[model samples]
Structure formats: C-alpha cells, structure tokens
Target: MDRLARRLGLRTDPHIFFWSAGLMVVFLVLLLSFQQPIGDAFGAGREWITTNLGWFFILGVTSWLVFLIWVATSRYGNLRLGKDGDRPAYSNLSWFAMLFAGGIGTVLMFWGVAEPISHFASPPFAGVEPYSVEASQDAMGISLYHLGLHTWAIFTLPGLAFGYFIYRYDLPMRVSSVFYPFLKEKIHGPIGKTIDVFAVLGTLFGVAVSLGLGTSQINAGLTALTGVPDAVWPKVLIITTLTAVATASIVAGLDKGVRRLSNLNILMAVGLMLFVLIAGDTVFLLRQLIESIGIYAGDIVPLSFWNDSMAQFTDEGGWGWQAGWTVFYWAWTVTWAPFMGVFLARISRGRTIRQFVGGVLVAPAAFTLVWFVVFGWSAMEIDGIGGSGGPISAAVADSVPLAMFAFFDQFPAATLVSGIAVVVVALFFATSSDSASLVVDMLCSGDGEAGPVRQRVFWGLSEGLLAASLIVLGGEAGLAALQEVITVIGLPIFLLVFAMMFALIVGLRRERVPKPVEAPARHQTAEPRPAQESPPRAGSQT
Candidate 1:
C-alpha cells in the first residue's frame, strides 16, 4: 500500500485517509443499493434528532456566540494567532473575500431569496400571520438570525482554536490538535487519529451538502434560461462539470485558484446585491435593512434560546418548523465547523484573536444582512405583503432552487441576470469544493502540507460523487437525505466542539500567564567574582 501510494504520488496518513474515504464509499454504495430504505432511514434519523436533541443544538450554538463575544472583548483579545508581532497574511479585502466565499457564499445565493420568502409565507413562530407585514419582518429577522453571528460563531470557535494551536503553539494543523491542551502528546495516538477521521467525514458530508444545494440551484438557473429540464441527470451533469472545474482549481493550489475565484465571487455578489437594491424599491429595501437589523438585534437573545416546546402542542407544525429550519441550520453549521475552521485557520495566521473573531463574526455577517435585505426583502415585496400569492413565493413553495431565478424574472433583464446568477453560483460551487478539498487533504496528510495532485483530485471527485449519489437517491429526497445526515453527524461533532472550547480556554489561559524563568544555580564555593561585567555607559560599546 505504501509503495502504491508513492507510485501514485499520494502523500497521506493512510489511517485517516483510508478510514474516512472507505466509510464514505461504503455509505454511498449502500445509499445507491437500497435507496428507499436508506432514504427513509435518513428521514427517520433527522426526525429523531430534531425532536429529541433540538434544545441541545439551540443551546450549543447560542453558547458559542456568547463565548466568542467574551473572548473578543476580554484581555485575551489582543493575543496574536502567531508569534508576537506577526501580521495577517492576507489583506482585509482578500481576507474577507475568502472568508465569505469559502464559508457562506453559496448558501447566501441559495437561501437569500428562498428562506425569507418561505418564512414570509409561513412564519416560524405562532401569532405571526403568514404574508402579513409583521410576518415579513419576522422573515427577515429569522433569516438574519440563522445566518448572522450565531452561524459565524460556530465557525469562529474552531477556527480560533486551530489558528491558535497551529500558529502559536506550533501544533499540527488538524482538528485533533485543538485538544492538545488535554491530550498532550497523545494527540499523535489513536485518539487523535479518530478525531481527525471524524473531521474528514464531517467535512466531506458538509461540503457535499453545499455542493448538492449549489448544483440544484445551478440546474434551476439553467432550466430558467435554456429551457432545460430539471431532473436528476441534469443535476448530475452540473455537479460533474463544476467538480471538474474544482479539480482544476485544486490542482492550481490555493493562491492561484481559491483566492482569485473567491475575490471574483465577492465582486459579483456585491454587484448583484447592489442591482437588486437599486433596481427594486430602493427606499423600501434601505428602510427594511435598517429596520430588520434592529429587529434582529432586539430579538436575537430570545430567539436563540427558543425551542418552541409550548408551541409544539398549541400550534400545528411548530416544532416541525423549528426542526426543519433552526435546528437544521445549527446542525449544518456544526458539520461545517471543522471544514470552515481549518480553512479559516489556514488564512488567518498572524491575526489577533479579536481581529479573527470580529472579522469572522461581523464582516461576513454584515454582508449577509445586506444580502438578506436586498434579495430577501425584495422578494417579499414582489410576493406582496398580504396573503395574495405571488410568483416568487409560489416558486419558493413549489421549487426552492427556482426562487432566485423567479425573482430575476420580475426584473427587466431576466435572462441576463439569471445567467449572471448561474455563473456566481457555479463559481461559489467550485471555490467551495476546491477549498474543502484542500482542507481535507491537510487532514489526511501526515504533515499539514498540500499533498499530491492526485490526492487533491481524489477528494474533490469524492465530494462530487457523494453529492451526486445523494441527489440521485430521490431528487428532493436526496437533498433531504444529506440534510438528515448532517443533523445526525453534527451531534457528535457538536460535543467535540464543546471539548474544543474547553481545550481552547485551557490553552489561552496558559498563553496569558507569564512563565517563570529559572534562577542560575548557586555556586557551592560562594564564588561571586564573575558577576561584575556591567555595561560601561549607555552609549558606549563594551
């Protein structure tokens, strides 16, 4: 096996790479072989987790947000991720661009319009009438809540841990290294390898989910523009085509491929958001942006902790809504933590803890707010304030992937903007795949360096294949299958995240305390003659 790996130019820790890849392959085969039963299992698992463990998910995520806030504001905030005086590798623009592109770019594209409109049509909580003005406010607020600080906070914790350990303590760049404070040298033992294996699986599933969603949205765009049918094959072809692009990007390495594409994604996304804001009711969106931010800030605390226990009995599908939306979002983000954390750590060397947390939590989140207001609020207005059904809301209900294009159809250059939307989603898809592949390679490799081209390509193709298999399971059932898988897998990773928090706290405390220097040993003979070599003068050389 070693000889074969070398011949194929693969540099990896055989244990982690083989175990993680083998398990995924086995699962994929099982999924395809017994589609119905496996799909049903996924659904059942999702229901069980959401019904029983919903509060754990809610509390876990909220705690992450509060913990990050405390870390950012406390005295520990000034600690640099690297050695003292080290500065950030990427500039603010490039850093923010990469963070947005890698972390949430594709998601924002997929859900910016769909989520808000869906919530408007059916508000999550009781007492908010769907399609009413208050419902619209609630919709935007809920959207922001899901995508804002809480979501980024999930990424921030692990990223901070990885960055601190990898850069400051000179630990290996793996999820297991985050627990070095507890595990000590045992990080290289089976326990650490197990943690890394789980990281690989979590990352694989997480990125696969993003790829699946992006493929769906891309196919919907194609269907809108070229009259192509939205079917399993089309989705497969989209995934295949973009996965190839991602493979190429990964081959080119991070700087040449991921960074450039990420910057482009940000530029294009900004252009789209600005177009929506200006072309639509500019005043309404501007007002909505401000009002929605206020609403989100005010309601964030209560909503973060809300589990809908009372509403579950009183209102129909109340817990179902929480399960489908909030819990799902939390679990999804949890799975992505390892991936995003590693990726963020890669780009975040030399930055201060405060800068890292604040940037991860605020900048992308601020853009997310603007994105929701522009696309989401615009879709809501086009869908109408009252219960009168509109095309955008109808599209969201019928086929979520088509929601963005449906909104585009309302504009003048429907085809052109939709085409642009397709390109943006495709770029996001590629960047996400390639970056995730890069991170997974680091996890699989013995050292944290990029491995052979074949290894990168292998992981990249694996993600696409896993996504394709899920999509082929039963179209929408496939998407649901992946969602359920994420939720279930996230429970263990969620516990791992808490352990990481504890380890990070321990590590940070040690970092802040000044270590005492050992005094020179006293001479047994009491010879003090050699102590008088003092400096001659302030300006004179001795």
Candidate 2:
C-alpha cells in the first residue's frame, strides 16, 4: 500500500484521513440504518442541553466578541500575521468575498428570509404580539443580532488565533496550532493530534449541516418551480450531483478552485439581493436598513446577554426560544469555527492582526445586516399586507425551504429570480464543500500543503455521504438532530476557544518584547564600525 501510494504521488497522514473518514462513515451508516433510535436519543439529549446549558453558549460567544475587540484594539494589533513586509496573497475584494462564501453564505440564503419571518410570527420575548409592528421590528433586530457581530466574533477568534500563530511563528496551519502557546512542542504529540482529529470531525459535521440544509432548500426550490417531488430520494440525488461538482473544484486546489468559486458565489448573491431590493419594497427596505442598524447597535449589548434566565417579563417561549434560536445559532457558529478558522488563515497571510479582525468581524457582518434587512424586512412587509393568504408567511410556517421562492413570488419575473436563487445556493453549497474538504485535508495531512487530490476527493465524498445519509434518514428532523448533536459537541470547543484566546495573548506579548542581545565575550572585541561619511576605501570604486 505504501509503495502504491508513493507511486501515485498520494502522500497524506493516512491515519488522520482514514480515521476521520472511517469514523464518519461508520456513524453515518449507523444513523441511516437505525434512524429512529438515534433521532430519539439525540432529541432527548438536545432538549437536556438546550434547557440546561443555554447560558453557556450565550456567555461563551459574548466573551469571544469582547476578546476579539480587545485583540484588535490592543498594542499587538499592528503586528503582521506573516514576517514583516509580506502582503496579502489575494485582493481585498476576493478575501472578503471568500470569507462570506466560506463562513455562512449558504446559511444566510437558507435562513435570511425564513428566520425573520418565523420570528415575526413568534417574537423571541413573550409579550410581543406576533406579526405586529413591534414584532416585525424585534424580528429583524434579533435576526441581525444572530447573523451580526456576535456570530462573526465567534468565527473570528479561531481565524485570528490560527493566523497569528501559524504565520507569525512558522507553525503548521492546523487547528492544534492555536494551542501552541500553551502546548509548545507538545502540539506534535497525541494530545495535539487528538485536537486536530476533533477539528476534522467538527468540520465534517458543520459542513454537513450546511450541505444538508442547502440540499433541502434546493429540493424545495425544484418542487416549487418544476413540480418535482420533494422526497428523500431527490435530496439524496441533489447531494450526489452537487458533491460531484464540488469534487471537481476540490481537485483544482484553493487558488484556482475555491477562490474562483467563492468570487462567483459572491457575485451571484449580490445580483440576487439587488434584484430583491429593487423589485421588492425599495423605500421600505431602505428605511428598515437604517432602522435595523440602529436597533442592532442600540440593543446588541442587551441581546448579547439575553438568555432565558434574564427574560424579566417572561413567557412560555422563554427557554424554548433561547434553545431553538440563540443557542442553536451560537452552537452552529462554534461548530463551524474550526473550518472557518483554517480557511480564513489560509487566505489571510501577510495581513496585520487588526486587518484580519476587522475584515472577519466587520465586513461579513455588515453584509449580513443588509441581507437580513432586505430579505427579512421585505418578507415581513409582504406577509403583513397579504394577511392569512400571504405567500411568505405560509411558506415559513409550512416549509422553510420554499420561503425564498415565496418571497420572490411577490416580485416581477418570480420564476427567473427563484431560479437564480437556486443556482446561487448551489454554488454556495459547492464552495462550502470544497473549502471544508480542504480544511479537513489539512487536518489529516497536518499542514496547509492542500494535501493530495485523492485525500481532498475522499473527504468531499465523505461529507456528501454524511449529508445524504442525514437527509435521507431524518429529513428536517434529522437536520435538527444533527444540530443538537453539534451543540453538544461544541462544549469542549467552546473551552478550547477560550484557551486559544489566552494563548494568543501570551504569544503576542512574547512577540512584542524584543529578545535581548547577549554581551560580547570578555576576550572578544567587537569589530569597529565604519563612519557613514568616511571617504571611499582603497578598494572602493569611485
């Protein structure tokens, strides 16, 4: 096997790849084979955590935000990620575009319209009347809150940590590198390998969540537009088809494949948003955009700390709301952080610490606010005016996959717009899979070498298989189950993030202090320095 692998030019940490993929395949197989039992178990465990540990997710994410800001504004902010004088490999436009494409562009597409509309019907707090003006305002506020800085802050930490340690210290680009300050040479030992393994696993599950949801939305779009049956088989087929597409890109490597795909994803997304903004309520969206920013800015602090226990004027939906929405979003972001972190670091060489934090936490977040404003506010206005017969609300209630399509239904050339939305989503799905495969490959091969095509293709296939299995086994229920499992898995990662932050601070402080030069030996005299204005030496050319 080794000789054959050598001949094929396929070099990888076989244990990392095989163990990660092998374990994933085993788990997926068991879940598919015994869906009911696993779903039941997951559901029970999920409820327990959502009920008990909701506060932890809230606190963890809030601390991450504070920590990220401090790092950005601190004395270390000016430090370059790479050696002094190194410049960014990619252009700023491509850098930010890929950030969105990798982090949660597909997630936004899946939920931008759907979540706010859902919140409009049921505000997070107890007393707000559903679908009322107050409800609508709070809905966008909370949606922005979730998709806004708090979430970005979570994603930024690992990226910042990875970039700082990996490039600055010449450390290998892997999840375990974040712990180098604390672990030192131990990062190469079993503990370090374990961290990397968990990172690969976390990334696998995180990407699966997006892939499964995107596939569901694509399935819904097809059914809505073409009268295609929305069944497990169709979703499975969608996964298979798109995974093949993603496999081709994954083989092309990051610069050619992921970068180009991400740029294309951003372009498609911008076109779709522009179409909605212009074709939908232009003035209303503009007003909502300004208002949403104020609301998010004014209420972000309270909202960041808002949890079931803190809901003073309570309702029955208190803890349930936190679990279903806030905790779930945080958990999802935390789980996806490993993949986002590595990918961000990969593209972030030559940037300063401040530039990285600002770009990761600010740019994508600003885009998210605008996205929710246009998609969320427009959906709310349409539903509010349309009443019970409103297409947007009805879709949100019955089938979230169809919500984006339903939102487009209120506009001109609805079918064309919906078709475009589907294509954009497909590309988001592909970019996400392609990037994730790269991250997992790095984890397996234990560096940023991009590994071999075989390894990338292997992880890509594993991701698709896991996503397909989850969709087929549990459908929407299965996706929820997977999310619950993710939140559960995120407990350790949450702690690891805090450790990384501490390690980063220590690493930066050490870097900031210049190493002292030793005195010359007592017997040895220093060479005399030449005078700057000295005439040319005899051997100098004049």
Candidate 3:
C-alpha cells in the first residue's frame, strides 16, 4: 500500500489489501497442502474456542459499551473526532455509509429467512422444542439474540478506539492503534511488529468468511430469481460481475461509492420489509415481534451470561446445531467488526461518544427486532397457521427469491419487486465490498484516502475470487470451515480491540489537568503580554 500510495502521489501508509489477500492465500494453501499439520494445530482446540472465544464476544462488547458511556459523560465528551478548529473529518453522506453499511445493510441483506429457518430446526433457548412452533419462535429469537445490542455493542469499541486515536491523538486509526499507549515502546520494536502482523492476518481471514458467506447466498438469490444454474461458472460469473460494480463504488471512494451503496441498501431493505408486512400477515407479525422484543428485554442479561451450553453441546445434539448459527455468525460478524469499526470511525467524527454508541450499537438492534417480528413472524405464520404445508417452507428455504418472486408474481408489481431485489442485491453487495475495499486500502496504503484505485481493484477482484474459490474448492462445507476460521480469528481481534480501548481511555485521562480556574476578569488586568499572547487554557482537544 505504501509503495502504491507513493506511486500514485498520495499519502502513504500500510496497504491493507496485501496483508488481507496474503493471509487468505496462506490459509487456503495450508488447508490444501498441509491439511494435517493445520488441523493438528487449529482443529485440535475446539473447547478453548467454544468457551473462551465465546466469552471474548460477550466480554468485548460489554466492556465497549461501558467505556463509551464513561467517555461520553467524562471530560472526553467535549472533544470530538476532527482536528482542532477543523470541520468534522467526514460528511453526513460519508458518515451514514460508514455507519449503516455494517449493520443495517450488509449483514441483514439475506438474513430475513436464512437465519429463522436454520434456527427453527434448532435453537439456543434452553427448553424450546426443535421444529415445533415454539422452536420457530426460539429460532427467530436467536437471530434477535445475535443481531441486537450485543453484536452492535461489539462494533462500538473499535469505532471509539479508531476515532479517538486517529482524529484526536494523532495516531494511525488502524487496529494496531488501540494498543499504542500501552505498548508504544515495545510496539516500535519487533514485538509491536508481530502484533500488527497478527492484526492484519486476523482481519483478512475474518473478512474473507463474511464476503464468502454473503456472496454465496447472493449467488443463490440470483440463481433462484433468474434461470441461472447453481454451478461454478454461474457463481464465478456473478461474483466477477458484482466485484466490478463494487470496484466502481470503491473507485468513487467513500464519498461516492460506499455512501451511495448504503443509501440504496437501507432503502431497499425498508421496501422489502414493507412488502413482507403488507403482503403477508401484518397483524400477527406485529403482535409476535412486539411480544418478542418484550421477551428479549426481559431475557437479554441472562442470555448474555448463558455459558452453560458447554455440557449440552457435548451431551445433546446441540453441537451441530450451534456450530451452524451462533458460532458461525458470531465469528463472521466479530471478524468483520474491525473493518466496520474503522469505517464507523471515519464517519463518526463531529458526533459524541454517546451518539456513536447509541446509533451504531442501539439503533440497528431495534431494526432487527422488527424483521424478526414481521418477516420472521410472517414465515412462521405462513407455515404453521396460514394453512400452507411443506410448500411454503420449501419456498422459503429452497428459493427465497423465487418464493418472493412468486408472491409478487401474483401482484401487479412483479416488475417493481424484481427490480428492487436486483438493485438491493447489487447495492448490498456493493456496500459490503466497498467497505472491505476501504479497509483493504487502509491496510495497504496506511493512509486514509480510500487507499488507491488499483489496490481497490485488486482487493475487489480477490474478494470475488475468494468467494468463487470457496465455492469451487469444496462447496458449503469448505465455506463452513472458512467461516470457523473467521470466528477463531475474532478471538484475538477482540483482545486487540480491547487493548485499543484501554489505551484510549487511559491516554485520554492520563493528563494532569490543571485545577479549574475561575473565568478571567472582565478586563485583562495584569498579565497582558507584549504583542501577541494566546488565550488561557479552556479545554483539551486530544
């Protein structure tokens, strides 16, 4: 990235793309060539991963919210994320892209069905029966489980870390910045280099899983809607085409590419929900969603600490059940947090710590509660009580796009819905890629100006290539393993972010603030300097 940045006459720093792509290639090669050695090392430790790794997710998010609240109410509240006397580093347009792209748009794109059905088959709730009506509730409940506060809470820390360090402390906002104050002396040496390397390593593997999972489902949607075959050629072709679209957005940079994609995405998502709410069982969904949110309110604290699943997984059949949803989604989202956090930081300038935490971590969970209520509820209602048999279930699972396509096919607005779906997918895909490209550029160029076009093109192509490669290499199981690696990588990223937040909090408060003085006398009485004396200290910026 530094070389490319120099070559392009832009500011230079660590280019993220090379590191990201490098890890992915390395992971793939190990899985293919040295499978035994890799398994012996990584595959050998499932227990430590399930318990401790899971705790990191729980711990990291909880701590982030705590720190954000502390900072917001503390002296840091007056200090925003831009340079002294400069406008906020980003505009509302760019900010919205960085903010919404992670939660409201990219992650939620295909989850309207994929999650509930899988959960219906199995659930995290203690006493829920599998495949029963209650099971369906519990399944949708899990989606709400992950999607709500805790997940977004996971995002807030890194955003805080990045924003505070990059905009305020004159630090690089990269993942490594979080560790700065605590490890500056050591980090400057080989020890620090290792941490930076691991951070980049973890970042690539984590993002790869998200891109791969999301793109695969996107391929499924395209195949279902159009008549494309579910084969390698079609998947590859679609990814390549979509990558170009995302690349175009990246070329436009965050101001154009990323922001436009997010706006379109949020709009498409609203329309989709409206379709489900209006065309399907609106009354029932509203009732259930409301009830579920109430239930979630009561149970969230308990759920956060529910680590008793240790024995149940090995005892009951919940092992396979959990490895699919909670574990996978946690890993994917956890890994993606760093990427999303950096983007979130870039946009969250001029905003308070309170606004940043509330908007990113709180608002989206409220939105997900609606989807589970409306869309997830509608799916359950159609299957259980709406009098449809296996057909609706088959429709939802085998071809969600086709089912929706068929639903709109009955209406006079099939053309419009189809157009929206295509546009939505395109925008959602672009939202994911553009952000990833920016992070890649961040990793590569080290500077913040959307990296470089050629670097973005390379990452855009690599993302498509990785998605296609996973599909061709071993299909769903390969994708599954790839995703597990993402979750596993998240454990360390979580720790790294914790370190960053710790540094931010400590550094922000470490100064020996002079005792507050009374407002100066109306006139400058005695200390008037010769010609040009600056005013007395009022407040700190960094």
Candidate 4:
C-alpha cells in the first residue's frame, strides 16, 4: 500500500483538498436542502455560543496577548527572517501588501458605505435611545466593534499559528501546519498531505468569495456613477480586468508591482478621507464623529457577540443577517490568515511577536475604526440632518461605494466627492489584485516571488478568471456560496490557532532568560535581551 501510494505521488502534507471540497459540498448541499433548518439551528446555536463563548474569544485574545509579551521578553525576540537570521525577505511595500490583502482591505471598501447605515437602522441594544433616529450614535459603535480588536484576534490566530509553525519550525507553509504540533509524528505523512489539500481548497474558496464581493461592489459603483448596466457582463468584465492587472504585478515581483500598488492604495484612501473632511458636512460631521466613537466603545462587546435570536434586523427581515456578517467576517479573516501570516512573518524577522501582533493586528484595527468614523460619521450626519440617508440607504445593500456617492453628493460637494470616489476605487482594486496575486503565487511556488514573471502572471489571471466565473453564475447567492465554503473549511484551523498560542507561551516560559543577577559581594551580569518584541530594522519597515 505504501509503495503504491508513493508511486501514485500521494502526498503527506495534510492533504485536505478532497476533504475541503467534500466539506464545502456537504455545507452547500445542506444549505440547499436544510438551509432553513440549519439557519434556525445555527442561529440559535450562535446566540448560545456568543452568550457562553464570549470568554472563548476573550480567552483567545488574552492568550495571544500573553504569548506576544513572552516573545518580546525572550531570546525569540532577537530572531530575524533570513535563513540564518540575515535580514527581511522584501521591501516595505511588498510586506504591507501581503498584510493588507489578508487584513480585509477590500472589506474596508465594502463597509465604508454599508456599515454606518447598518448601525443607524438597528444598533445592538434596543434600550439605547438612538435606535430609530437617523444617524444614531449607537450605529457607529456597532460598525467599529465589527472592525475592532476582537475581530482581528479571532481572524489572526490561524495565521500566526500557521506561520510560526510552518515558517518558524520549518514545517510546510500550509494551513495544515497549525495541526502539526498536535498530530504527533504522523503529520509528516499522507494524513498531513490531506490536511494541506483542504487548506488549499479553503484558501481558494475564500479568495473566490473575496473576488466576487470586490467585483460586485466595484461593478455596482461603476454602474451608479457611470451609465454601465449592473448586470452579469459588467461584473465579469471587471473581474477579467482586475485579474489581468494582478498577473502583471505578480510577474513584476514584490519589489516593483506589489509595493507600488499598496502604497498607492493607502495614499488614495487618505486622499478620499481628506476630501470628505474638506468638502463634506464639516460641523455635522465633527459631531457625528464623537458620537460614533462613544457608541463604538460602549457597545463593542455586545456587537461582537450579537445573535439575531431569530430576529433579523428589519432591513434583512431578521437579525440573522447580522449574525451571518459576524460569522462570515470571522471565517474570512481566518481563511486568509495563513497566507497573510506567512507573508507577514516572512517580512517581519528581527521584530518581536509583540510588534507583529501590535502593529499588524492592533494598529490596523485602529486605522480601520478611524476610517469608519470619518466616512460613516459623515454619512450619518447627512442622514440625520439632511436627506442623504435615502440615497445611501437605497444603495447600501448593493454597493458601498455607490452608497457613499449618494451621501457625498448631498448638497454642494457632489463633484468633489465623486472625484475622490474615483481615486479611491482605482487604487483600492489595484491593491487587492496585486496582493492577491502575490499570495496565490506563494501557494503555487514555495516562495511568494519565486515563480518566473510569466508564471506569476498566469496565477494572477486565475484570480480574475474565477471571479468572472462567479459573476456569470449570477446574483448574491453565488457570492454567498463561495464565502460559505471559505468559512466552513476555515472552521478547523480555529482550534489550531488556540493550540499555537498555548505552545508559544509554553516555549517562551521554559526558555525565558532573566536580565541580570545582583549579589552583595559582586554585581556581575551579562547583557540581556529586552522583555518585549524587538523593533524591525530601518530597511524592513521601508
């Protein structure tokens, strides 16, 4: 049997491809056959889970924090990324792209338009006074909570676990690496190959979902602003266009294309915000910002654990949709974690775990919340005092950028907001495509940039191709199916994330070194590493 398996080239790296495909098929079949029953069951289950597992996530967050602290204070903090602790793998732009792509930048594009309005319509707590009032401060709170620390913690665990074990421990850089420490020695064989297969499938499903969502939103925005039809063809066309661009950038390697695109995207996002602050509702917007921040801080916990209780918020006909949003976001982040984490870990040598968790996880969350505050707050002001909510609301469920256009064109600033929107979308899509292509290349080749330029280009085109296929399939259902697969396959890795946290903590404590020993007779000591994650060198950050 072993001889035959080897001859057939059967794998040993947690070959989960068949399993992921089966699991996703099962999920979809169940979705089609027992969706109502499953939704009802899962809906209640999530509420119960939230009520019971509030601490589950909190525990996850806390443990991750401790592990980070340990790394900062240990010999591990002195480590860098090269083969023998040489230096970083890529330039600043390339590293950031890898992180941002997996970090949910596309969601930022989606949420900038949809989230504020979502909270405005129905915040987490009914008792809050702002429930029905347009531009309720509570709404912004929910939006922030959705984009808050816990969400990143939930999502980042798998990535960190996968990266440390795979990249750090010299295990194969696959999602299956998370389960390696637990699998004993057998994980290096066929069973491990099966697991890796599932992980790859999981990543594909997740990326497919992202591509579909991104294309839809982009298509919707283009349709609203331009006279293009919001149909299957346009979405398909956009996907094709994006994939072509991604292929070219990936081929150009990280130094040239990926970094250039990401920096451009970040700059555009800043410029768009600046335009709103400069030309949109200045006074009302300032007031909205304060209220939104307060609402976010106060209600974050509840929003993070919200379960619809069979109550879909009125807009979707039940709070279940909100539940879907939470669950889906968590899974998407987890699914993308491995690729992003590896990419981050690859670039982040010479830095402490504290820095990685803090900068990558914490800082990004802060930036995202701020972005929400600016865009959502501005939209809320328009909704409350002006009739901006009508256009925003009408477009919210469809495309976020379109919704923003409606809100921004409120009075005298129509053309200015429109111009900003154009700039943001252009950079936004480029960032996503470039990062995604790089990630796909990593999976296809051992290194992120190892493939020949043309090879990377082929993979780059694949991203757009699958997205176009999804568009041809039609409707939100197609997109939802793709997302569901990512979430389902992403489920097992969550446990692996917890396990990695535990392992890192244990490893750190066992090997922890003290600063210096002081005695009465003689105060002699050797220099010690700092008790925090080390900062990256000048070149790495750049």
Best by TM-score: 1
Whichever of 1 and 4 has more lDDT, that candidate is 1
- Per-residue CA lDDT of model 4 for 1-542, tens digit only, reads 34543454433211232344355456545555664565455445555544343334444544554455455455554432222343455555555554664457777877775777866654555454332453456666656766766666654555455445544445545544445445644454566556555455455555666777777676666665677887777777877777776666766776667677776677777777777777776776677667666676677655544455545334343334543566556656656555565556555654434455666667677777778877877776665633334557666655444676676667465756565665556455655665655654454333433444544564456556555654454344545554444445555555555666775554344332434342221132332222453321111000
Cα misplacement distance, residue 460 of candidate 4 (Å): 2.6
Q: Highest lDDT: give the candidate number.
A: 1
Q: Model 3 residue 158 lDDT?
A: 74
The lDDT-based order of candidates, best leading, equals 1, 2, 3, 4
Residue by residue across 381-468, what tens digits does model 1's lDDT show?
9988986769998998888899999999999898999999999999999999999999999877735567788889999999999989
For model 2 the TM-score comes to 0.91
What residue pairs are clashing in model 2? none
Model 4 is weakest, by summed lDDT over 10 consecutive residues, at 533-542
Poorest 10 consecutive residues of model 2 by lDDT? 533-542
| Better-scoring candidate (lDDT), 1 or 2 | 1
- Give me the runs in candidate 3 sitting further than 4 Å from their true place: 1-11, 14-25, 28-48, 51-56, 66-78, 83-94, 130-133, 185-193, 313-321, 385-419, 476-479, 511-542
- Tell me how far the alpha carbon of residue 488 in candidate 1 is from the true structure, in angstroms, after superposition: 1.5
lDDT of 3 by residue, 1-542 (tens): 56664666543344333445567688667665764555445543444576446555555566666677677666455455544343455665545545766444645655665566556644556676656777775666567777777677667777777776666545555565556566554543455545655665665556555555555555655664676665556666767787888888888887777777777678667878888788876677777866897777776766566554565545653343445555556666666666777778877776755566666766677877886677666655555632333444565555433444433344346567655765676577767877876775574444566654776777677766665655555443545456445656666666676677768767566532223254322222332211232322211111
Q: For every model shown, what is its TM-score relative to the native structure? A: 0.93, 0.91, 0.82, 0.75
Q: How big is the positional error of residue 247 in model 2, measured in Å on the Cα after superposition?
A: 0.4
- Give me the runs in candidate 1 sitting further than 4 Å from their true place: 1-4, 315-318, 476-478, 513-542
lDDT, residue 323, candidate 2: 81
